[model samples]
Target: MRAIWKGAVSFGLVNVPVRLFSATENHDVQFRQVHEKDGGRIRYQRVCSIDGEEVPYSDIAKGYETSDGRMVILTDEDMKSLPSRSSKEISIEKFVPSEQIDPLLFDKSYYLEPEKSSVKPYVLLRDALEKADRMALVTVAIRTRMTLAVLRVREGVIVLQTLLWADEVRQPDFGVLDEDTHATKKELAMASSLVDSLAGDYEPDEFEDDYSEAVEALVESKIEGGEVKAPEAAPEEETEVVDLLAALQRSVDAAKAAKRGGGTKDEAEATPEKKKPAKKATKAKKKAS
Candidate 1:
């Protein structure tokens, strides 16, 4: 893949020439708006609201609304006059433990490849961060905005993940939630046990976008001249009202059974089968041969 940006990663006098490549790809099918009756491609027009006439691109200019219902027009040169740093550097500000960062703050990831001459410093930084269990908090400008990012090692390669600023996140106000109700100790304990039983290693490959898969299947069927039938939706399970203690007990039992079922299946698959040793050569078989 082509590099999205060519820049140097700078920290404490160390500048490593690196190229940034997008780590993720979008596989979603895209659709365009079209005229349904004529099957013609839809086109958008730039029109002046006041004049009710289509305007050319040259007539467009950026404007901001003021409190007095007036617009302040800004020219391209005026925007260019604003002080901004070039999007050519990944400037490291500090190092922090990766665990301290909230997963929600991360937005996107990009792979960092070192220039041939800068491989030494790249590997040095990657190894140092891996050993220290820390990630470098850096800032880099992409497009026209500067974004906070985390630089860390992933599978022996440096990866830069963009992060949202702390201020960008809204504070959670639990005051809106009903506080008069309380959970019993037994109920809480059972819930915790159920969570523990279900806990396992995170494997992204194990999950899939089921909705997208179904949509693709439908599309493929239509393309192949096969009749696509609407699938019958499963009936929703009704919620049962039961005593809190009984519900908790049932949950615990269900969790245990599920865990045992999974363990049995896993063990059966993992166990090695005993192969019957080849039968001793019979004198009659040798004579027939």
Candidate 2:
């Protein structure tokens, strides 16, 4: 993976040169809108309402609307005049107990790799943090905005996880939770028993996306069953809803299966993409189907 940003981590009188790289990526399936009849992809264009004409990309400018409904267009030069922080350093403020930082504050995580010359200092800081069981609170500018982050050692590497400000976290104040709530002692005991019975080590690799797997299986079944090859056949719709008890039982079974070393290959799986083939190819594919 390529480094997204290059900077130095500053603490005390030491500055360790490091490269920042995103540590996570999304693997969710995505879909595009298309015409069902012809299988043509749909696209959107930027059109102005005033003249009902398509606007060129270069003609667009940022506009701030005032309370009085007047739009003030801001140009590139005007945006440059606005105050923004851009720094080439990740300045450490202080080290605090790792447990004090809530998981919700974390936004994104990045790995910090030290430069050849700065390896010694980087190891020094990592060792200090590990020994103290703490995380370093830091600030760094990224792209067009400043971010609050925490530096912590993970798997022999320093990981910088960006955080959200306090104001960004909404106060959970739904009235249903505020009133006096009570659970029967029997119910509580059963819940605790349930929790204890299911508790186990969190091996992230054990879990799989069953929905995506089912989707692929369904598609493969259709292809082999000649549903697509013979479009004249009625389309089959399969849907099932598992009850609460059934779901709980399946979870337990899955845990047991995991204990038996059950797992699929770790490969990026995405929803199948529907593309508009060339005219002749599309015709041939449809005719063959």
Candidate 3:
């Protein structure tokens, strides 16, 4: 795995240089938005709501909407002025019982690999944590933001799991839960017996994602049966626009050529010539002779 970040874990005077790698990934079937009729890929544009015009990326700025329907545009300089951490040190704050951390508060997880020279110190910390049955709560700066995380051992490797802030977790409030409710003894006994009968060790390998498997099978069968549509052709409007521009250009060039040659052939043929009055007198003299 590629290391996403290079940082050192600092606890007191002990600093172990390590590389951080993401420990989990998603493997779900992916899809794209497309036109159902012609299989054309769907596209979207960033449009300004007030002007109803598409906005370019360079012109975009972060805007914060106020509760009173006002917008505050923030520039890049303004964003940089905000307080953030850019340290490469994962400073250990303190160690606490691993059970104290609520599973719901956990966010992203990363695996820490020790540097070649720091292996001894890294192993010492990992072994100490395992023996104490504790997790080191630490503050790590990732992407210029500082967040709380915990360091724990998993299969002899130290894993860093980020945690959500306490305020971020919502309190569960429901009217049904507040109402007084109790299961009868007989019903409770039957439920307990049912749970006992179904209780077994959880083996992740035993579970199968039937839905994703079925989707893959369906797509493969369609391909094998030749059930597919050709990609949509380009729109004809662009070609028409190009032809119009080319015709206008040709007309301009023809006009320029005619102006340089004095006039057009049609114009010269339509012009009237000066009439000679002696033509009639010449014809009469010839007849008298």
- Name the TM-score of candidate 3: 0.79
Off by over 4 Å in 3: 230-289
| Colliding residue pairs in candidate 3 | none
Q: Please, what are the lDDT tens digits per residue for candidate 3 over residues 66-94?
A: 99989999999999999899999999999
Better of 1 and 3 by TM-score: 3
Query: TM-scores across all candidates?
Result: 0.70, 0.72, 0.79
Candidate achieving the largest TM-score: 3
lDDT of each residue in 184-230, candidate 1, tens digit only: 99999999999999999999999998878988888898868854333
Candidate ordering by TM-score (highest first) = 3, 2, 1
- Which window of 10 residues has the lowest lDDT sum in candidate 3? 267-276
**Model 1, residue 98: what's the lDDT?**
90
Give the Å shift of residue 9 in candidate 3.
0.4
Best by lDDT: 3
Given candidate 2, what's the lDDT at residue 278? 46
Worst 10 residues of 2 by lDDT: 265-274
Q: Which stretches of candidate 2 lie over 4 Å from their true place?
A: 65-70, 217-289
Candidate 1 C-alpha RMSD relative to the actual structure:
32.4
